[model samples]
Target: MENIFNFNDESSINNVEIHGEYSLIIVILSIIIAVVASYTALSLNKRASENSFFHKNFWLFLASLCLGFGIWSMHFVGMSAFSLPVSMSYNNIMTVLSIIPAMLASFIAFYLANLPRRNLWTYFFAGIAMGTGISSMHYLGMYGMEMDVVYTYNPILFLASICIAIVVSVIAVYIFSTVQKYETNYKVQLIISLIIGLAISSMHYTGMAAMNFYIPKGYEMNLSHFHSTEMYGLAIIVTLGMTILLGILLLSSFIDRFIEYRANYYDPFTQLPNRRLFEKKLHSPKVLAVWHIHDLEHINREFNYAFGDEVIRRLVYIFKTLTPSKVEIYRIEGHRIALIARDGDSAKQLKGSLKEIATVLRKPIIVKGHEVYLYGVCAVSDANQYENTPNIYTNVLAVLNYPSITYNHDIVYYDSSIHTYTFEREIADDVNRAMNDDELFLVYQPKVCLNPNETVGLEALLRWNHPKYGFLSPAVFVPILEEYDRMVKVTDWIIGRVCQQIADWKLENISFKQVAINIPGEYVTSPLLLKLLTQKLNEYGLESSQIELEITENSFVKNMEEAMRAVGEFRKEGFSVALDDFGTGVSSLSYLKQMPISTLKIDKSFIDDVPISPKDSAIVQAIVTLGESLNLNVVIEGVETKEQVNFLKGASRKPIFQGYYFAKPMQPHELIQWYRETRVED
Candidate 1:
């Protein structure tokens, strides 16, 4: 043991002392290389966990290569900085082989860092594995030196170097694990990189301190060639090569991040900022307005979806061209676009802009060589009035859905006066509950024949007895249900209940004419309604003539062809159809000529002040005359006084009257009792 191992004692006289000097510039450069490499590896590791299996493995491999080559380059650069009082060079094969340990160590470190479940024990084992690899690489590279000298190490300092390396590895692993929690925190990354760089440098220098080199007795030192240019050139080449590789990796990562950001924050179809980005940009004192394309679904159904998409693109383009630069637009949802204004006069300016856009939208837009007419309405709200952006967004969406505001092509500013919006929102949220809890029911109003002075038929009116808000009128909740696309289900429920009631009435020996049901505009146009009515009638073992369908004039306004076809189908099946709420819509006179109807019921608005109001009397006279001219059965509604009845009786033709004048809407039992009493009197 004494012959093989020679402990280098400082007091020995035969040993030659050789001190090495360092180039300050090369030392600093080595430290920078270590830091850059660490940052790149850490950044890569951060993204690895978020990637797919293939991408995650690819990133890990690249990170390992970067850190491995970086450490190798830094080691050589640091070695090139140290100059001894002798000529020294390294074996090429050994120098290359030393990098294997570094890469292996890097892979281990990153793999452990990316483990799904980690603990103190995981980090400690990772540190131990990494520290062993680093120590082996350092000693192996040190031994690769070819020189006419003997090498020795101080036992205590040698162990101390290994300890320092292990400690640094533990710390690097811990910091790498912690720093990943913060996203893109460049300041913290820099600080961590610096600390890692300093720690690596400390371990390398400590290993160097442990090393001692002495010239053999017979060897002669060539001091003149101590500074080798070739060696310095090698270090520079390695550093540059590693830097270029890292730079390429960084560029690739940046491109990936950019694509990810675009996908997350922008809508692919409109190429506009999406709801996520819009919500992020919401701040105080900003005016928010949402423009909803009311007839977009109709357009999509009539044409193809592609044509509808083109329409939206064109609308967005028009909005961008017409609105000022201060107003930022976002594609919030299907058929809905949102705008935010940040200027001082944003509310007034935004309202004006909305009106301009609405006017422009009224004109038919040419898409795919087809002239497509679209109806849009804007709901504007002040952000300052709300507590947060979410509140503003919620209320604005509710306001946009207001039945009066929809399809009007007008801009409505939200205020306390728009209480209908709030009430409608409540109704929409609770309507399903209303159905499940049997809160919805029907009341029948008797339509009397004026000439015979007897009850002719009954009109079924829907009523909601809400647990929270009692006795809600159909006028308030029906439109809400329609706006929310829930009318079809409610209408189905209504039809089923009416059919069962008619069956029950027959069992009780109650004799009456057919009962009239007011079908919503949506139900009238929907193909499902006819099928449902047929199914219900057959299920109840009743003929179609026992039930009557009352459709409003506006029902024809949506899709006249479909509404007319559906009504025609109903009439063909032996069911009578009444054009309810007559003479209320703008094109009622024009549509009356085409509508296939058995009855025309005048709206109550024209009958509320009939005797005194000359205009009301004249309108009523014209409607009655029009019904008689067409030979259609006319029903006058909202007659609460006998004077209105006398006036109607004086008309050229007698018509059915339904109002509070004779009998209000009643329950099933009351209607049965009233029918028997009326029949007895007749």
Candidate 2:
């Protein structure tokens, strides 16, 4: 019985050695092919994960071919190492046919490994397919052998070889799945490749060892005698072809990865390197300038996104045309173009370049037959500003809200003394935490009514005793909050706190004629602030007349009409509005008339020099007389010295004052106690 399964007598099989007679170079070459192909496949794996559906499929298919060819190459090379005693030839058709199963098995294994999502069942099925396919390929190649003998096999040993293949397949798939795309552990991969090579080799030789070949005495061969020369030529041709295929795949993967790298770090619309690449190269001695498009949002809102995109593209051209070769331009964020000088230069040169950029941007561009005018602010890096920061983009963005930059629309260089990026972030974080954690509280500075010799009112001031940075002044933290646009939120919190305190004082039988809270200039006209104020007053069951909103002079100076309207709204709603920092701002008399102000608080600068500088005395008298003529109560703040107080009294018929001279700002309880103690004297 030829091709029979001989279960009973194992002695019927020919003695087969696992190694047989093999060329060391051929065996080593096959292992090398496996290692190289496997490594290339791993390289493509990460890209396959990140790519689009179509591109991912393309890479995955190539990976399958890459790994499959290596497996096919290893099998062929290992087969060539097997030396038979009798003259042997292979059926040409079957020898070629064996590669089909080998490649199919490889594809199944790779497809399972590269599946976007995977689990236990997919792995199990993939292992079964790969193991069965490898076993079938080995036997198919064996079946191609033409010799004057009948072949038989030990079923148990043959089954064991298949089992070994299946187990190895599962292990290989597990390793592939566990490996990360971006990170390649070369040592682990090398070890894995070696292990897989040995496992596949073991299965091939084990199956071979289980097979038996016998002459059967009557068997006759009609085929041509096998030649060593043709076998060598066949081996060389197959090895060369597989080698070339793997090489091409490896080269293609390298190029694809390079292109992917470039795409990730660049803005596709502008074809400019993005913020990520800029930050990677951020360092001292390199000048950076950020240009912000002032009206991009308006353009986007008026026109379509496509029109906005076109506008940005045109702006990119201007940047490219005007920028020198030495300076690298990057489209960092939305409507923001950043310039970095590759050649180390002073901030002065960058500042000039930024000014030129701003001037060029002032011109108009035609987009789709509609002339579009551009306006923007350019902020330049300072030469002497030395602060190590992770995100230079954010550091530059900090300039966007600077008073210097906000008003002038010119290049505001980074000032290390005034602009501290890290400190700002720390303070913001602490403030937010304090807001949430009830760590913030308030203190009050008493306002004296001179004629009555009593504390008439108290200005509610925000206070924070930070665990790390103790007793932070409003001057230090408030400006930073405003720059970050968090002042509105802080103000809302402050309003609630102040209203609750006022309610608490009522319960304690402590009273004041009025209480004032300083409001940011930006919030003077805010509807939200008005709504919040109305709600808080109602919540505390207090009248609006009891609380005053103190606004800075700059608010009225910047937007007179809006400021006046806001002041009128406050007064109409039964709340008093006062103009703070009176003498320091431009057009002092203009603010008094333009604003519907009930009180004018003379700023400390003019009051500080009173009685000492004669010029300061004239300025104080003028402000006092102006307030009296307008029928507005005048408050002189920061009145520290007895001499300044004397001068203020002589200059004005009556004076209401606030500052350290009368009493420093105190906690709510301390204010109540001081009032109780001072009421007796009045």
Candidate 3:
């Protein structure tokens, strides 16, 4: 039959001085392989077009094209180097080499930019499959010597074959995942996973298809003749290596793009995830960690906003030192840095670790030779499915507001129960109402003179009347207010009301004497708060001596330099400052000396259990003795019983006050009514 294949007629027509029928076929297949490889190069170049390195894309594309064509040429040139007769079996082997185009086509399809740079194993796997195909065909061609084929499979060697395939395939995919870069999109991870899966499938199928070559007469296949005859082995190595290397370099360029984009999204101030970065990476099924700088606003007002900004930076540095590599850090707005643990990595231990870090951070950063210290409220979320980063974030925020955990310098992790959250929400609602309705009332816990039955002044205790929940105690709402932005608003309302109430009584010919109001650390820095108090005093025709702003020792010296300066600001404005809860917090001799405070209100805790609880009694005595020596007015609180009052009078702590014993806090009308009623009862 006449040959219909046009390439068969190429020998008779004489092109490029063809040496053998097999040579003609090899050249034809080589040309096709070269063309397909060129297309692969173009395909890769197309993917690189949007890359920052894509300008270098053209160079890579040209290089790939030249190299791919050279691989095909070299394969044939190496084949030509073999000393082989123009046997029919040899012609068949050359025909089988045509499949190289198919392999190249698949390679083009698989080399992707959106995959992980870690999966270069895909390319290595490809090399393994190609090598297997080449080696199998070479052995099959050797059988064309017309000898009986003998099959020998060693168990160890057979197992090694499987091992090599898997190892190479896995490593290839890993390389691809590692080098393949995508935009900051998370799909890149999934894409790399898919590509590795494809590589495994490719290796398996190619290995399955490896078969023996059928030999024809007039061909002697020997190792020496084989080396002399065919450069196919070397061609296989060089060509596949070049192809895999190109894939790596190409994929790696995109990975570099992803990394560069990620770096751009980092927050400059904190070196954590910026707002843009957080929104992008925050995902479903994630845990959120919230870290709050507890005294940032106070820091800003006293030392200037720059100090606050530095505190934020310093906090970030502490977090960077404390967290694990698998944890992702995000700067959530101002004064909060959040950590999102990568793959739930070490998340269970996050709270404890964060607490320790917070304690370490509290040890004062030596900023400009000043020991600048900071504190944090850290909360982790419940490890539940509903916890997308947003929900997890909410959970963590809720914990930061958890009064017991936050106030005590402890970190709290999430619990499934909603009771604490509900409690906090209710308190916030009441606080807001108290701010608006003037329903927020103070209880005058009386501080009585030890020997005399006369009341000198009342230490104002905060109380709230919820339209729904009845009278809410200061213990529940005060700390909540203190931690958030609303504390300043609430404090202003309390101060304004107290001053006005005292004024009305004086007008009524009742000597209300001095009234003490608790001032949150936030209020101390507020110049507007002072102005508000001044306005109220002037309107009510009250003197500066009529009002006292009581602050705890903790609040008085939280940011020492800031607190000292702010106290001076308060004193300068004619409002007297009291060291409320003095012995209870940081009782260093320096605080009493440095603070521009007028009165020392011994903490209610020390006064409540005094004399009976010897510890409490000593604290009371020490605080009283300190105040007496310093010429500071000593006011004792929490006098629930007459026996406690007797103890304070016996201890020589003169002019003391108490909480429960005086009168549980009353409204403005009740306070005036109680004063009028006190004299009537007397």
Candidate 4:
């Protein structure tokens, strides 16, 4: 039944192939069709989301179909040639050439049609229109070809063609899904998908055509065929057509993504839900949900953004699995937890117990192969109250900051009457004060050597004493600075003051090893980092080696390239760089080699329960081994108990320690007095 248009003839003819005026028209028209189809396919793929039925990559296969048909046109026109008689059946022969690519287009459109979608029937009818148009046009066109050819095994050509089609369609589907995976406007994905579509299509069409080309029983190598310029030209033309068209499609796809990416709302980092995505979920009061992270700064600091991102990812997955199938999520600026919960009568009990529901929603996040215990505070509000539409975010934030949540770190219910604008007002006022006030000062947390109990160094921590609002920890104000880009200024002040303190200690003959300054992760990546530190240290007449910089793993892990560069700049200038909060985050061995590190400071979490906690002992042992292997110093912080010190005294061979056991962090005047007393008393 399939062999009606089949011919297995390999009879050689002493006639030229494709040397007629009509053949030229077929090739040209075919090329135009191929061009149109390829571009259309790419356009379809780019707008995959806007259309329901077409799998994201359906357009990719469409491109392949166009290119394949174009090649078929070019190939057959080249095939049906003669030294004498003109091809009266050129249209009929062309029909055979165009069928496969059309079939492929049909197959792809059908796949998309079957997928779960709203307007699938529209695509189904369009698929009918295009598929019918292509096939009918080809069948009517092939009537002029006196010779009929069918796919067969002896030639090994037709099998390759069918295989190629199957592969192209499958690959187009795969590429479409993979490219759309991140849902971004990045150039690489589009380029790769287009290339894949072309490659798969080329292989399919060429394989199908290759089946008709039979080796005359034993002349398989066809050295003659290789020598023939016509055959070579045909292949070259075919390859060029597919390549050029596909290449253009690929480029256009990339350009489209770039444009859409710029036009649409997005967050480049974390790739989670963004503010725009959140807005998309604002339609139905019963169809929306929002979750605001309570301690983003702590997450950013404790493990750095790398782990912080992991926490966000886990939280997303948790809520995603927990929510109803139709729910949507958005992450707003990576701070202040906010989630819009769907208030549906469908789930009556679930809607009423909002607080209980929120607690279940807020759970621990796993990062770096270890579970990080955290509690979430969220702002879930009723979207039904369409009060002031323009200022929904303000209300959302207010709902998130409901006064009840000020004390409760866990999730809180949404209340319309209670506005949580008081703290934000205070913070704004404090920020205004910080711009002019030189009152941000330092407190020295004493660091001591374990065996001798001798004071080694002091970690400089920032303390803000606002005239209006008592004393403030770095925890509160640091976030404000980070949010407002004032962190750099604050960091500069800490560095300068710490350097000045080190110089004063030197003048008093304290020989107080090093003063460590806390560095914010976001600010550490500046190219002028070294210049800033050099200027500060030189201004104080302090040696570079006298100052140490401490970066919590959270900061260190977040911006690896910048972090390493900053560390290298410091170490190159003879300053020491230490990894603060060791054992609290994912410590890649590669970083140990890349970073300009002098020390690893054990975090307080590990130290607070050391000697008693076996886990701490194991972590300390591992860190010490790592330090020894890398030839860097290891210092344990927060060593208050003698048992902890005694444990460190034996286990750490050349170890340095810092903790409350030596002395508490003091003021600059107190540091000077402590330095003088140590010298005079000794």
Give all TM-scores, in the order shown.
Answer: 0.47, 0.48, 0.38, 0.39
lDDT of 3 by residue, 229-267 (tens): 355654674566456646654665566555545555676
TM-score of 3: 0.38
Candidate 1 stretches greater than 4 Å from native:
1-20, 28-66, 84-101, 113-125, 135-199, 202-265, 283-286, 298-308, 345-356, 366-371, 381-399, 405-408, 412-682
Candidate 2's TM-score:
0.48
The TM-score that candidate 4 achieves is 0.39
Descending-lDDT candidate ranking: 1, 2, 3, 4
Q: CA lDDT, every prediction?
A: 0.76, 0.71, 0.56, 0.55
Predict model 2's lDDT versus the native. Answer: 0.71
Clashing pairs for model 2 are none
Query: Which residue ranges in model 3 land beyond 4 Å of their true spot?
Result: 1-426, 450-453, 680-682
**Leading candidate by TM-score:** 2
Kindly indicate the candidate among 3 and 4 with the higher lDDT: 3
Off by more than 4 A, model 4: 1-425, 435-438, 451-453, 506-511, 676-682
Query: Model 1, 40-138: lDDT tens per residue?
Result: 876676557542223676777777777777777777788878877577778999999998998888888878876766788888877776677667778
